[model samples]
Target: MIAKSPLRVLVAPNAFKGTFSAFEVASAMAAGVRRALPEAQITCLPLADGGDGFRATLVAAGGGRTSRHRASGPLLEPVWARVGWLPGRSGETAVIELASVAGLARIARPSPHTAATASTRGLGELIRAGLRGGPAEILVGIGGSASTDGGAGLARALGYRLLRADGCEIPEGGLGLRQLHRIESDRVDRRLAGVRVLAASDVTNRLLGRRGAAAVYGPQKGADRATVAGLEAGLHRLAEVAGRDLGTSGLEARPGAGAAGGTGFGLLAFCGARLFPGADLVANACGLDGALAQADLVLTGEGRFDRETVPKHCAIVSIAQRAAPNGPGSPGAL
Candidate 1:
C-alpha cells in the first residue's frame, strides 16, 4: 500500500536583504518542502518584517493585486512603486510599502556617508491613490526608507503644511527640517480621515535618542557625524512642535518609534495610528493562525537566524510558533 503523504506545511520568511528577497526565499524553501513530500500540500507566505520588497510579498502571499504609481524618490526623481491590494469588489483596501518610492536604493551613498534627501511624498501619493478607491483604511508598511524628514513629505502629499517660523513653506527632504517651525493642517485632505491609518514597522527606536532614528539609522542613510547631530536636532524640534500642537506627551520612545526615518512619529502625531511589527501585521492579514491550525508540522527559517532575529527580525515566526497549540510551544520545536 502507498504510504500516506506528509501533512501540509507553511513557508514564511522575511527578505534576506543582499542575498534573497522574501519571495525568493519562500520559493526556495517551498522547493525543498516539495522535494521532501511531493504529495503534501505546501503554502508559501513570503513575509516582510516591514522592510524591502514588502508590496510584492504581500501581493503574492495573500493573492493581492498590484498597481503602479509614480512617486518622488530620495533624489527628487520620479520612481516607480507598486501598491498591493486584496482583490475584491469592496471599495478599496491597500497595502503600501515605503521602500517602493523612498527606499535606500534611491540613496546615492551608504549610511553615515549618503544623503538623506529622499522624501516620503511618494508614499503619500500612493496612499492617496488607495483613498481614491474609497477604501476604509490604508495599511502603510514603513521600512527601508531613505528620508529623515519625519514624514514631512508624506504630510505634504496629504495636504498638511510644514512651514518655517517665518511662515514660509519648508522644502522637501531632511534639510528642510532645519527651517520648520509651524505646522498647518486646516487644508489637510479630509479624505484621509475616511480611512483609518495603520503603520507596519519592526523597529522600536523612538523619534530621538541614542537609539533614535537619526543616531541609530542616520549612518545608514549617508549621514555623517555632523549630519546625524544636525538631523537629531531637527527631529527633536519636530517632536517638540508636534507635542506642543497636539497637547500630549506623545510617544517618542514607543516601540517601533524609529521606523521609516521617524515617519513613525509623524504618523502617530497626525494619523493616530497604532504600530506593530511588520510581520505580525502581515501575518494577521494572511490568516497565519488559520493555516497553522490546520498543520501538523511546520517549517520556518530566515537568512541568518540569530539572537537578534528572534526579538527583532524573526519575531513573527516566534510568535506563530508560540501561539500554535502544541504542548511544547517554542520556535525550536518547529
Candidate 2:
C-alpha cells in the first residue's frame, strides 16, 4: 500500500481586539491543530487588515525598519506613533496606519460630543513626517478611525486651511465641518506632488446619503440621531467645498469614500490617493498565495463573526475564498 502524505494546514488569523494579538491567535490555533492531528504540518500566518496591528505585521513580512514620532491622536492629543519604513531602490516606502493615530480605541470615553470633535490630524502629520525622509511611496492603512471630520484635520496637517467664512480656521471634528467655508490651497503640502498614496481599506460606502460616512459610521463613533444628522450635513458641506476648490467632485461617490469616517474621502481629495482592499494588500505582501499553493487546508478567523464579517470584507473570509479552488479566482489565500 502507498503511504499517504500528511495534511498541510495553514493557520492564519487577525487580531482579536483586546483579547489577543494576531500572532497569539495564530499560535493558539496552531496548538489546537497539533492536538487534533499530531502528524499534520501547520504554518502560522498572523494577519492584519489595516487595524491596530497593521504596522507590526507589514514590518515583519517586508523586513522593514521602524521609527517613532510624536503626532496628534484621534482626539488631537499627542501620541507617540510608530511608522514603518520598507526598503526600495530610489527611496523608502512609508507604511502608516490610521488606527495608530486616529483609531476609535484611542478614545477612553465614547460620547456624542467627542465623536463630533475627533480629528485625523495625526495621520497627515505622520505622512508629512515620513516625507521628511523623502519616501518614494506612502501606504496608509485607513480604518478604525475615531474622527468623522471628513479628514479636514488631516488636510489641516497637510497645510490646507479649513477656514470659516471670516477666514478663521474652523474647529476640529465632524461638527466643525458645518462651519467650513473655503479651503486654502496655496499652503497645501508640496511634498505630496509625486508620492503615490494608497489608502488600504475595505469599506464600500460613498461620501454622502444613507450608505455614506455619517449615516453608516457616525453612530459607531458615538453620534446619536441628532449628532448623526449634524455630521451628515457637515460632510455634505465639506464634499461640496472640496469638490469646487480641490477638484474632488466625483471621487466622493466612489466606493470606500465613507471609510474611517470619510478619511478615505479626505485622502482622495487632498492627497490624490487610491483605495485598495487592506487584506489583499497584506496577503500579497506576505506571499500568501504562494504558500496557499503548497497547502492542503487553510484555517483562518478574526475576533468575531458578524453579517458583514463573513459576507463582505472580513479577513478570514477573504483568505477562505482564496483557498476555495472551486470558486473563481480562488487560486490563492492569505
Candidate 3:
C-alpha cells in the first residue's frame, strides 16, 4: 500500500476461531482506521473458508439475499437453514452451507452411534428448495456435516432408491449401507437436468481407506472403532454400487470425494457436482479479485497466523496471496 492520503483500504478477515466473526473483526478494524485516518476510504468484506459464517460472507460480498428453508436435520428432525440467493437467470446461483442445516455443531448429547446413524437428507432437501428457484447453479459448502453415510441420505432424499436384497428400501445412515444391494434412480428430480452444482471444500481425502472420509472424519463425529470400520465398509459398498449402476467407477478415489463424511462423493456420484477449494470459491463468488485491483491497502486477520494458515486454505491467506501475485510471504502487499 502507498503512503498516500485518502488511501483505499480493503478489510477482509476470517473468524477469530472462538472469539469473533470476520464481520466483527472488520468492523472494529474499520472503526479504528476511521479514528486514526478520517480521510481514508475503507471497505469491509468478511470471509470464511466455506464453513462457519459462509452464508453471511458470500451474500454480503456478492450483493445477495438470504431466505430460510425448512429441512431435516442430521438426526432427522425439522430445522430451518438459511440459504444465500444471488442474482442469476431464474436463479443465477444459490449458496448454502451444510453446517447450518445438518452439522455436528447443532447436535447436542451426541450418542456413541451418532456417526453411524446421522444423515445428510436435510442437505439434499436444501438443494431441492434452491432448485425450486430455477437457478442455473447451486454452490454448496459441504463442511461440518454430522453424518458418515457417504451421502446415501442425500441421494435418498433427492428421490434415488437404495434397495436391499429382498427388494426392500435400505435404511438411511452409514450402518444401513451394509444392507444396500443396489441403487435405483428412476425417480430423481428432473429439474436437476441442466443445473450445475459446485461443492466448496478443500479436503483431499478419498471416499475409502486409511485417509478416507470414514477413517479420518468418523472419529470426530463420535464414532468408535467398530463404528468407524462399519462406516468405512458402508462407504466402500456405496462406491461399488454407484460404480456398477451409475457408472461412476473409481470416483471414490477422487480428491475431496470423502469430504463432509463422504458427502463429497455423494455429490459427485448423485448430483455430478464439482469440488473446489473453499477459499478460491469464496474469492471468486465475492469478486475479491476486483476488490484487490482497486485497493491500495489490504488487511486480513484470524485467531492465529502460523505455518498452517496458508496450507489450510483459509480465506485470510487467500486475500493475502491475491494481493501479491509475485510470491512467498508477500501477502502483506499487492
Query: Against the true structure, whose lDDT is highest?
Result: 2
For candidate 3, write residues 1-334 as lDDT tens digits.
Answer: 8766677888887777546878899899899889988998998878787677777788887789988989999999999888888886565788989888888887886665788899999989998888888888999988778899998988988899999999998887898998999999999988887799998875667899998998888888899899999999999999999999999998999998998999999999999999888888888877888887767778878777775355666787677667778344232442
The sequence of per-residue lDDT tens digits that candidate 2 reaches over residues 1-334 is 9999998888878888757888999899999989999999998888887776788889888899999999999887889998999998888899999888889988888789988899999999999998887889999988788989888888999999999999899899999999989998899778898899988886677888998899988888888999999999999999999989888888889898888899989999999999888888888888887877777777777777777675345477668766786465333343
Best by the TM-score measure: 2
Ranking by TM-score: 2, 3, 1
Q: What local lDDT does model 1 show for residue 11?
A: 74
Q: Worst lDDT window (10 residues) for model 3?
A: 325-334
lDDT order of candidates, top first: 2, 3, 1
State each model's C-alpha RMSD to the native. Answer: 2.9, 2.2, 3.2
Runs in model 2 with CA error above 4 Å? 326-334
Each prediction's TM-score versus the true structure: 0.87, 0.94, 0.88
lDDT of each: 0.74, 0.86, 0.85
Q: By summed lDDT, which 10 consecutive residues of candidate 1 come out lowest? A: 325-334
Off by over 4 Å in 1: 1-8, 34-41, 87-91, 111-113, 246-249, 294-297, 304-307, 313-325, 329-334
Predicted candidate 1 versus true structure: per-residue lDDT over 152-238, tens digit per residue: 788888888888988888877776778778788888788887677888887777888898888878887788888888888777877
